[model samples]
Structures are given as C-alpha cells and as structure tokens.
Target: MLRRAGLPIGPAEILAGAEALSRIELGDRQQAQAALRATLVHRREHFEVFDQAFALFWRAPSAPGEAEAGEVELLDKAPAAARRVSEALGGGASPAPPKVEARPDMALTVSAGEQLRKMDFEAMGAGEIAEAKREIRRLALPLAARPTRRFRPNAAGRRTDLRATLKESLRQGGEVLDIRRSERVVRPPPLVAICDISGSMARYAQILLHFLHAVSNDRDRVSTFLFGTRLTNITRQLRHRDAEVAFEMVSHIVPDWSGGTRIGEALDRFNRDWSRRVLGQGAVVLLITDGLERGGPEELARLAAATDRLRHSCRRLIWLNPLLRYAGFQPKSQGVRTMLPLVHEHRPVHNIESLRSLVETLSAPQSRARMPS
Candidate 1:
C-alpha cells in the first residue's frame, strides 16, 4: 500500500512493519499505526501519502462497502485504495459487492490533483504516469505573439502603404482612391526543443515527449529532437494526430534510445546540421538535459563552444534541467558549469508545476526572460 502510494517502501521495511505489528496490540490502532509508520516511512515528503493510504486501507467501512471515509474528506482516493485493500486482504474477490458504483469517471479530489501536479516525474507510479500523460497532452503552449520586420496588409493599420496604394491606383488611371495600409507581422516565435534521452533521464524523457507531441500538433514551426549519444529529429513523427502511432514511429527511427550521455557531441551535430535550418526568425530554444557530460575537460570545452553558438543563433536559450529540483543546487558538474552562463534562463522541469511556469514564461513578453550572464 505504501509503495503504491509513491513511498520508498521495500521488503525489508515490510518485514520490519510486520514485526512491529506482532509486538503491538492489534486492538489498539494507534500503537500499530505508529509502529508501522516508524518502520515503513523513509522520507519527510512521503509522510502525508503514507498517512492517507494507511487510513484509507485500514479504517473500518463507513457504509456497507468500505468506500466512505472515516473522518477525512479524501473521498475519491478512498474508492481506489479501498478496492486495492480488498484485493490485498480478501484475495482476488471482495467479501461483499460494493453497492456504490464509485463511478469510473469520478475525478480525483482537488487536493490529490494538486499533489500530482507537484509530484516529481521520477517518483510517480505507473498509474500516476498514465494520469500525467493525459494531463501533459492537454497542456497549451500559447506563446506571446511578437512583431516582426515583415509587413502585412490591413485595412485599419496605422502605417500607410505608398507602394500598395500606387499599385492599386494604377488600375484607376493613376487616380487617388482608397488608401492602403500595412501592419507589422505579429506571430508566435518558432520553438525548437533539444531533449536528452539518456538512461538517467529516461523517466522524464517519456513524459516530456508527450508534451512535445502536443506542442508539435498545436502550433506551427515547432521542432523536436531527442539526444542520447546521437541526435534524432522526431518533429515530423510527432505531427501525427494519434500519439501512440507517432511514438512507435519515433522509436523505430531513433537509434540511441537510452544510452550513454554525449551532450556536447549531440549539440555539436545539431549546430552543424539543424541549427541554421530551425533557429531562424526569433526562435525560442528549449535545451532539456541534466548537463552530465561523459567525457573529460576537452568535451566540456566543446559543449561550451556549441552552447555559445546556439545562444547567439536563437532569441532565447532556456536550459531546463531536472537536477535543478534538488535543494541547494550548484553548478558543480563540468557540463553544468560550461553551459550555465550561456543560457538566457535556467529552470527546473521535473514536475508539471514547473512546466506550467515554462508555459507562462513562454507566453510573457520577450523582455520578461532574464539572462544568466
């Protein structure tokens, strides 16, 4: 129950918990709960989850089917936990059929939903990962439109188009008729995502790819490339409306799915081949990696050079590092030190909340993004 709730519980902890239960009086729930928690719980952050799961799994039934809560307002979570408890305690079959259907569409309570938004991608269970995928697909990456040097025809624009006016008047025997106007082209900037798919980043990579797929289908001029030891452009593959088909296609084409990290080599390849092609017209670049270079100082120098060039080419070079979620984080790694001073913004991307912050930053004005150096 604790493991399913995202706690780092293991067989040893389970054995210790069973021994504690043996020593405690089973009739006194308080002693049993405390002893079990003392053995089972590992981290401070997982305490609330343990408490909720314990209460839901062990409390006596409020109604006929053990679905209702004893005192807590954790209604929706109770049903699933109750069902899991029933399976764990009553074998595969329930002691009595649940009278309440516990509607399949019953949405998670506000607290549980918020907890999921704040949960780390690495700590989530399989069920939470599926739920996170559905949430990621629905995210809207609406960038703030910026004006370009190019002009477009508009009836009520402030700028008068003398050339267009003359061209129009030529058809009327060169006589002045209605005035032609023009407006500066306002458009969403291009988005180019360079994501790491190394073994260390495997958990975050899968979820982020779903987000990239959504962005690819939602907007124009969005490019996605995955990198481990090599860089693979999966932008075209993600254009398919069906996500599963698109992912399968990406899997077939990308040679290095979960391999060693060669951050510099991959970025150098991208700079040589794809940068000029995609980083035009005020492009916003998202460099998603943990900045863990595999090679020595020479490789770090190459990463720095490639990153500096990339900074010059793109309008905004934002670094999204999952390692930034750690408390008291520092640029101790060679790769992190090489690239930190070059990026326009450094942000964490380990949870949905951080992604929401990214979406907001992308939608704000250009001046809102801060430069690191």
Candidate 2:
C-alpha cells in the first residue's frame, strides 16, 4: 500500500514494517498505526497520505458484489491515490471491485496524448490537428512580469511613502506614528504576434493561431496581427470566446490568406501605422515567418528597416521559424540574412514541445535572452 501510494518505501522498509506489525497488537489501532508509520514513512509531509492509506487498508468489506471496502472508502476521499493503485494493480479490475460503467467521454488515453506532444504540426492530419487544438487549450502561457514606474503601498517597503502617510494621518487626528512604504508595481508586458500566412506557412499558421488564441484568452494585453500579401490586425477578431468563430471571422477579414509573400510591404505597413499603438511599454514581439521574401533588394531593404524599428520598440523580439527545424538550413536568402541580426532569440515553432520551450524561455528574466551572432 505504501509503495502503491508513491511513498519511498523499499523492500527493507517493507520487511521492517512487517516486523513492527508482528510485534504490535493488531487489536490496538493506535499502536499499530504508530509502529507502521514509524517503520514505513520517512518524511514529515507524507504523514497525511500515509494515514489515509492506513485507514483504507483497515476498512471492512461493505457488501457482496460491491467494490472492496478499502477502495470504496478511498474512492471519494483520496481519489488520486485510489486511481493510481487501481492502475498499478492489473487494469484497475482485480483489487477494486466492479462498479457502474465508466463514462467513455472521460477516458483520456495517456500514450496518445504523449505522442501528440512531440508530433510536428505541419505533418498532423485532420483528427490529429483537432486533438492538438484540445491539447493547446490545456496549455498555460506564463509571461515574465516586469516592474512598472507606478507604485503601490507595501508594508515591508524600505522607502517611505509620504503621500500615503499623510492620507492615513488624517484618520488619526493628523498625527502619524507609523510611516507607510511603497513599492513599484509589477505587470506583464504586452505580447504582439506578427505571423506570416503565406502559402508555405499556411499549415503552421493554422496551428500557431490556435496557440495565439489560447495565449490571448489566457492573459490581458495580447495583440495578434497576420500578414500574407498585406498586413491585417485580427486582434479583435481573435478575442472571441469560440476559436472556430474567431478563425471564421478572421478568414473573412483577411483577404490574402494563403497567397503570395510580400514580407517587406506588410512589415512596412505595420511599422508605419500599428507600431506605436501596441509596441509601447516594453512589449515582447513574436515574429513567425519563414524569411521567404518575394520582392527584390528594394523590398529586402524595406524589410530590414521595418525589422530594425520593431527590434528597437520591444524589450525582446523572438523570431520563430519552422524552417529552422531543417538540419541543413542555411541563411542564403537576402531576407534571412537581413533578419538574422535583428532578433533577440531565434527558435523553431514546429511542434508542441518547441512551443512549451518558448514559454519557459519567455518566463525567464529578460537578460537571459541573448541575440544570436
């Protein structure tokens, strides 16, 4: 029971527990409990879990054709442990007696979910993409909170807050015995995602947009913009509660969905019109593209200028390219060379595991994200 409960009890501890049980009177629950706990448990925090297992182990059978009394006692109280024990003991059928049929909808296959985590988004089929969307919904995106110029009252703050002290003094006959302190307020910076929806990036974009939608609803101050032949701000459309409805509205709003790539022009439009509105307050920008510019040197020059402006406006700019997953990838194109020096971090966004790694990188301190040489 201790091993099944995930306690660190070895064979030696098991034999020791058995010896203690043999020495103690089985009729005395208190002495037996103490002896078993002393022999089996090694940590203070695990005492409660051990106590639960002990009580369940001693329970009597309730009736015929029902679950074992031990399992019945734990099914409602310590469900996670009970479920773990059931799985460990032969398909959860032998030790724990049978009950009503389990709901088919609640059955989550563990191996299938694990496989999806490492599967590449571009290679996923229709059903796999649907399952990946469900998995994406369960993911949590945590941003690194930055300290702001604004201050809030803090009792443990070192600096004196004269304004707060004066306000509090008014209630105490204008005589202040305690001086209040204040600390700078901290908040998550805005997240701006500039995604490429060109033909080559269509499959990756669909999956990434789902991820963006999840991040958008997970926190405040998130803006999303999609670019193909032209730039379109679908931040408002993506704010819808329903993902399907949001994507449907986005399709109608964005005229160029899986069209030609005009990276320079789209970026130029964003820098000229939308940069100031969303790129303030040390924003973090996620640039999702394959670095495949269609136009000539003039367009590449424009893209370089726009990317420079974007880098200057944000605290950290991460470039996520699915092409980076290629083992023989080289920055041979003018567009790729121009973008290489501008981003703080360059990473692959080809799978769920990569996305999770991105989340971890973003949660770290800003100083940790270094510009690639």
Candidate 3:
C-alpha cells in the first residue's frame, strides 16, 4: 500500500522493515511505527504516507458495526492526501457517501504536495498560495544554453586552434605532439516576462509575479514587465532580494493595477522602448495574458504589428494565455487572433501543472518549440 502511494519501498526496504518490527514489541503500536518508519521512510516528506499506510495495513480488524459507522463519512470528507491513498486502494469504486464528513486527523494525510502541484492557482486558499510560493522559489528555471560566436579553450572541442597548438608544441622541443582545441562558448539565454495585470488576469498575475520574482533572482540578465493600460518595466523593482519588498516597490511605481487591458498599446511600448535593450542574445520572452482585448478593429492592426515585431525581436516568443485552460478555447478575440500566429507557442498558465510544464518547456532541448497554429 505504501508502495502504491509512491513511497520508495522496495523488496530490500520491506525485508528491513520486517527485521525492524522483530526488534520492537508488536503490541506497542508506537514502537512498531517508529521502527518501520526508521527503516522504510527514506524521505521526511514520505513520513505522513508511511504513517497512514502503517495504520491501515497493521490496525486490528474493525468490529462488525465499526466498519459501517465511518466508511462512508471517511470517504466523503477525505482530504486530498486521504483521497490519494484511497486511489491506491481503488478509489471512485464506491458511489456511497456523497456528503459525509470524515475525521481530519485520523484521515490519511499523504500526497498533499502532489495534490498541491496539480491544484489551480485561482482556486487555492491563502495558505495554499503561501505554500506554493515557497515551492516556486525552490524551482530552478531549466533554460537551455545556446552556443555563442566566441570560442573557448577545450581539450575535447571539435575545432583545433593552430596558434595555441604551435605555442604548446614549443614546450615539447618543437614537436606538434598534441593539437589544442577550442569550442564555441555556450550560455543560457536571457529571460524576459511581459505579464498582464488587467482585471481579468489579476489573480493569475498575482501568482505569476512570485514565480517571476524567483526567476529574476535566480539568474543574470532577466527582465520583467507588467502591462494593463501601459507597460511598466519591473525589472529594476523585482531585483530586490526580498520578494515582499520587491513587490511593494512594484506596487508603488506601477500606476495601472487591475485596470482595463490595452494589448496593442502595451506591445507597442515594449517593442519601441525595451526590445533593443533586453531582447538581445536569443532572449526568451514569456507573454502572459488572457487575450481578451477591449480594443476595436483598427487597434487589432496595431496589435498584429506589435506582436510581429516582438516575435521577431526574440528567439522564442511563448504566449502563456490563461484562457487556454478552457477545452474549447479559440482565438476568437481580436487580441488573441492577432497575437497567436506570431508566437512560437501558445500555452496555458492557469495552474501549477501548467507552470511546471512551462519550466520544462524552457529547459527543453536546444531546438525551438513550435506549437500547432
């Protein structure tokens, strides 16, 4: 059962657990738990799952009426951890309790982190969001490194440096014994995030800024901008070491917050002012928005022009639209239609799973990403 919960309980660990139980008094539940846990639980995070599995697998069989008293309520009010553990034991097999409340403490509290990883951001409570922020800070953006024009000295490099080889041969009595080689330098591309802070996207934006803040502090030459009515360069503001202090600085400087979106105007501002400054060295741009433009047909032309220019300015222009969460999502809005074709990829950003996918995509193989039109 613990193995089903994704615990690393191999045959060796099982044998060890059995041997551990032999050393402790079987009648004392606490001693047995501690011994098994000491032998089987390799990770601290797996302790809860180990405890729950131990309780279920080793508990004395329930009396005739005792099982009937709480089975329905336990399943109904089960927390995410309990639900995960149940999935191992054939969850969703019973159609019984639709609204029964279970005991929180006694309920299996396993897989909470797994549940959190898949949870939608907007649906999360304050505590969950806080937990998520800590998780985000721990993430390392897996940005692939691109080969630069300049070459560096390397013994295993393909290209031979004739000049260096000759110089080194002088030390060997003018004998060209070994040819020195050099390889093109490889460096991770700069990352720039242009996020929407419009009323509709504010909640997702709030969460993404935490992610961006972590990214900004993690590496060098990362830039960030916030756009609603106009584009506000937040690269400087987000550079603060403290996330809370950095966001406070951004909140003070940015004039438009949770306001109407101006897709065309914001892109124009980015293309004209910041493109040349930051979009150098194969920069990867993350354009986050919902694509619900409030502009007219005329503005759509400008939107198309700006998006095209921005796309040309960067190596990869990824559109992280929260609207893509919908199953039947389409580029029906003027803004999305104008921007979608210009981007290398159009992906969702509504949940943690999507965010993790984005991280994976960024760290993908050197070849640029190309999503379907």
Candidate 4:
C-alpha cells in the first residue's frame, strides 16, 4: 500500500516501523492493539508496511485464534501485494513477467579470462554462443560524443540576430539589455550496424545475434540481417519489446541455420536490395564471417567489390572474423584476402573483450590505412 501511495519504503523502513509499533505503550492492551490495528489500515500506505510487518511478526503457526490463522493464510496467498500496490499507485497492472523457458543445461564452462587467449572459434556451439553473447553485452564501450557545430548569435561565433534582440529590448520598455539569441546544436550521427549470419557463420551467429539485439535496444538506428544461401531481413523482428521473443521470432524466420554460406551471393543481394534503403545516413557495416566462398574467387572478388562499394556508402565498414582469434591467423583464403583490403576496420569477434574492443573502435576514428591491394 505504501508503494501504491507512492511512499518508498525499504526493508529497513518496514522493520523500523514494526519496531516502533512494538514499543507503543499500552494503558489498556485491548485498546492499544485495536488502535494499532486501526492505524495500520488507516490508509493504503499504512497497510503496505503493516502487511509486511504483520507477516514477519506473527508467523502463521505462532499466531493465535482462527481469524489470525485465516489472515495469515490470506497473506500467504495474497496475489503478490507489490503488483496490487503498483496498480493502485497509478502504474497499472504490472507487466506480465517474462516467461523463463527452460533449455537443456548445455552451457560451456570456460573460466573467465583463462580461455580468452587460446579459445578456438570452430569449437564453440549454440549454448556457448548464447553465453558468449551475454558476456559480450556486458562489455562496456568508451562512447565519445562527436564534435557538434552549434549556432551562436554573437558575432564572436555566428552572426547575432540583432533585429530580434532589439525588438525584444524595445518590448522591455526600450531597455537595450538582456538581449538573447538562439543556437541549434548538431546531433551526433546515429550508430549503424549490419551483421552477417550465414551458413559457416552459424557457430558465431547466435552470439552476434545477441550482440545485435543489445545494440538495437540500447542504441538508435540499428539494422540487422541474416544470410545463408539468401538474405533475410531481421530488423523488424528484433524490434519486439522483449529480446527473447525477438530472438525466437528471428530463429523462426531464418531458415538457413547451419547451412552453406554464399558470401558473394548474399552481398550482391544486399547491395541490390538493402544497401540503398538501410545504408543511408552514415551507417556502419559489420561484415561477420570466415570468408570462405564456395562460389570461388570470381564471386568473392565481386562481393569484395560490392563491399568496397558499401564502404563508400557508409561512414565505416568493419570486418569481424572469428578466425582472427587464432594467434597465428593469416588471410590465406582468397575471399579473406579480397575482402580484407576493403574494410575500414578489421577485428576479432570471438570473445567478450573482442566485442568490447569492437565497440571502442566504433566510437573512435580509425587511423589505420586500408589494407594494400
């Protein structure tokens, strides 16, 4: 009831209130008990703390009388008082709590930081991917506000609107003082993310999907997609108020789970279909994959060329390769070598720290030159 009455009471406050009640002197025990009970229910605010204290003080088993036992049972069965209080406080019925669906306990048990150095990307499964994605979401990024150009009325900056200020001064009894001008500050560009979810990319997809969900909800203007043999737009699905529901929807939509990858075909389709649509307003593309092309080098080169075209369209193009997690990583594959040169940033997407680094890179300006042809 206190919560309903908009009174914030912690556990300590409830206990303190109970203690104070217990200490009240009784000239007549019956009268004092009646007065206390009346005080407890005088208002909703009183009932909230009183209910909690009563439950604690008179354990159902110890409380005397049939009425007291019935009250205790009612309290035990009381449809979570917090929800009622919240509703009464004008918050409405509390939102239905998320359903916790039980999945097999198949989570990977890698010790923190111990496996960061030697973790192999190819070895992780769906369960590990989910946990890894959660871990990645926990990683923080150093977000720096972009420099904005604000308009100023003073000649020291931009030209002052002398006419408006003089008019205002005249309106203030001809006083040529307290002149004011307005300025518009430019907002920083929104962050754009384009993630790849394809066949060979399936092992890394779940974690990245979680990462995409986090980015979508936490930041503004995020676009996501999944592609195996074909491209499936998942931007709308990830917009569900609940992340789990969004992902479940995505899992249902994406048909090529653990299927074959066609990087060139997917990129070509994206270039034709989504690039002009979602790639506008200075977005960043995060092309994630191992860069193994079954379509051979020609198609890989064509996709690489399209990726380069995408690079021109966006503020940044980053390539996140799980293969880069290997200490002795090399761009031996033709597809990798072809695509690497086109990206503005290249980083590993294997673990939490790597994801953290990716966020940091997104915020900072890159200094590295494009990889040599």
Measure candidate 4: CA RMSD.
Answer: 22.5
Residues 1-373, candidate 4, lDDT per residue (tens digit)?
4433223333544565576567766565545445455543433433544454434344455445764555456446543443333334343343585875965354755554556423443333233334565666665543444434555554343546677778888878989886566554544454545555544565467667777777777766667877777788898888776878998898788776555678777888888888888776456678888787767657877888788787887777778888787778888988887887788877888766677767777677644465332
- Tens-digit per-residue lDDT, 5-24, candidate 2: 44546556779989999998
Among all windows of ten consecutive residues in candidate 3, which has the lowest summed lDDT?
67-76
Q: Rank the candidates by TM-score, best first.
A: 1, 2, 3, 4
**Best model per TM-score:** 1
TM-score on alpha carbons, each prediction:
0.71, 0.67, 0.65, 0.58
- In candidate 3 the C-alpha lDDT for residue 127 amounts to 53
Give me the displacement of residue 50 in model 1, in angstroms.
Answer: 23
Query: Regarding TM-score, does 2 or 3 come out ahead?
Result: 2
* Winner of 3 and 4 under lDDT: 3
List ranges where model 3 is wrong by over 4 Å.
1-110, 155-157, 160-181
Backbone clashes under 3 angstroms, per model: 0, 0, 0, 1
Question: Candidate 1: which stretches are off by over 4 Å?
Answer: 1-110, 368-373
Superposition TM-score, candidate 1 onto the true structure: 0.71
For candidate 4, the lDDT comes to: 0.63
Q: Residue 134 in model 4: shift from native, Å?
A: 2.9
lDDT of the structure predicted as candidate 3: 0.80
Model 1 agreement with the true structure over 1-373: per-residue lDDT tens digits? 5544444454667899999999989999889888988888754544555666677666665563554434235534454443333333332433574677566544644677798899888766546777998998999999988788899999999999999999999999999898999999988989999999876776588889999999999999999999999899999999999999999899889877655789999999999999989988899999999998979989988999999999899999999999989988989988888889888899999999999999998888786357542
